[model samples]
Target: MRAEDEPDLVRVSLAADAVFAGAGVELPPDDPRTLLAHADRVLVATASDGRPCGLAATVAIDGHPHLEQIAVDPAHGRRGVGSALLAAVRAEAAARGHGRITLTTFRDLPWNGPWYTARGFAPLPRPEWGPELVRLWEAEAGIRVRPRIVMAGRPG
Candidate 1:
């Protein structure tokens, strides 16, 4: 993602959060600026007009890329934007010499856990979580009421 895309990160994230509302899941508002700034690598998917429609943000965790956020504007849904962003994250992780990518997500949300599962990620049991991942999961649990799972997938 380019520096110019930073301004659109918040917009894309909020638009993507609409999915959670539609699914009857209440989530705290998302502000992606901080994460965007700190991400190990960020990938953006653009609309035909050259505006950003999706983003995948990752941070280093236990020496591997951990997906911090993946958001696609609802207006651009079903266009493979999210998938493309994720694939890019995986490829980038591989290029960085990481064998796998990790993440935390709602266990049953169609667009959350299931989406990752369909793309090759599998649930990573608590015992397998690294110190940083365990801390991240615990922190997330304090703020989120939904059941969440940690997952990892090869950087294919």
Candidate 2:
């Protein structure tokens, strides 16, 4: 994603979250900039009209990579945008020599935990998560607002 894509990306992300999560969880204005600055890579999926349809951000920690955020526009659901973004992030993680990729999702939501599970991620015991990720979960409004399942996938 380019520097100019941050606004649209953030917009799509916030919109998707609001639709799926029923709460307006917008990133801080500078959050996208910070994510792009620190992430191992950021990937976005756009529609034919060039509007961002989905996005994913990955960052490395403790020699493993974690998918920090992934969002797909409700209008574009089941059209493969989320899957493609995930594939790209997984490939990027493998290329970076990361052993595994981890993510957290709403346990009760079909589009959240079930989707990840369908894509090969398996539920991870909370005790297995690192302190950094645990702290992030504590800080995340959505995760704190609802019960979530943490999952991980090892690169094959």
Candidate 3:
């Protein structure tokens, strides 16, 4: 993604979040910028005209890839943008010698947990969490009220 794409990706992130609001999951309104701010690796999906319409941002956690956010504008949802970004994220993580990708998401949301489950992730036992991951889990708990869960899968 180019520096020029930042604004559009931010827009995509915000617009993609409508799904959560519709689901009655009231995420912090200030979250997208904060999450995107810390992302070290970001994959962007573009429209035919080349504007960014989706994004996948990842950061290292416990010395492995951790997906921070994967957001696709509703206008582009259900068209494989998110899936492509996930595939690219996995490929990049594997190329970097990472063993697996980890993430936190709402456990029951179809687009959150179930979506990833269909792709390859499984619940990561809490006992397996590293110190940093435990802190992240706790931080998430401090910020939201939802059935959040941690998951992992090989970055193949």
Candidate 4:
């Protein structure tokens, strides 16, 4: 994605996530910018017409990779965009020699937790999260107002 795509990417991510989840779970204004700033890699999937359809970001932490955000435009949901973006993240992690990738999502949210679980991410005990990840979850807890489940997956 080009620098010009940042606003639209953030818009699509927030809008779609709100639709899929709910208003209270929406991303804050600086959240996408922060993710893009810290991520070692960012992958975006576009539709046949060249519109942004999905996005994912990955950052390295203590020799492991963390999948930061994965968002799919509601209009493009159930297509291959989400799966393809996640595959890109996994491939990028493996190429960087990371042993595993971890992420957190709302435990009871159908689209949030179940989607990742179906793609091979397994539930991880909150106690097992590294310091950086723990901090992230804590920050999210402040914003989301809903309990989240942490999950991790090893490269296959």
lDDT of 1: 0.87
Worst 10 residues of 2 by lDDT: 21-30
TM-score of each: 0.94, 0.82, 0.95, 0.86
Give candidate 1's TM-score.
0.94
Per-residue accuracy of model 4 over 1-156 as CA lDDT, tens digit each: 678778868877776666744545654445577677777877888888887777898777656888878888888887878888888888877777778889888777777788888889899887788888878877776546566788999764
lDDT of each: 0.87, 0.77, 0.89, 0.77
What C-alpha lDDT, on a 0 to 100 scale, does residue 11 get in candidate 3?
89
Q: Candidate 4: where is the Cα deviation over 4 Å?
A: 20-31
**Candidate 2 global lDDT:** 0.77
RMSD of 3: 1.1
Question: Which digits, one per residue and each the tens of the lDDT, describe model 1 over residues 11-63?
Answer: 89887887888888888755678788888888888999999999998999888
Query: Which candidate has the top score in lDDT?
Result: 3
Error (Å) of candidate 2 at residue 137 is 3.0
Comparing 2 and 4 on TM-score, the stronger one:
4
Per-residue lDDT of model 3, residues 27-56, tens digit only: 876657676678998888899998999999
RMSD of each: 1.2, 3.1, 1.1, 2.2
- Model 4 scores what on Cα lDDT? 0.77
lDDT ranking of the models: 3, 1, 4, 2
Q: For model 2, how does the per-residue alpha-carbon lDDT over 31-131 read when each residue is reduced to its tens digit?
A: 55566677777788989998777889887654678897887878887788888888988888778787889887777677778888888999988788888
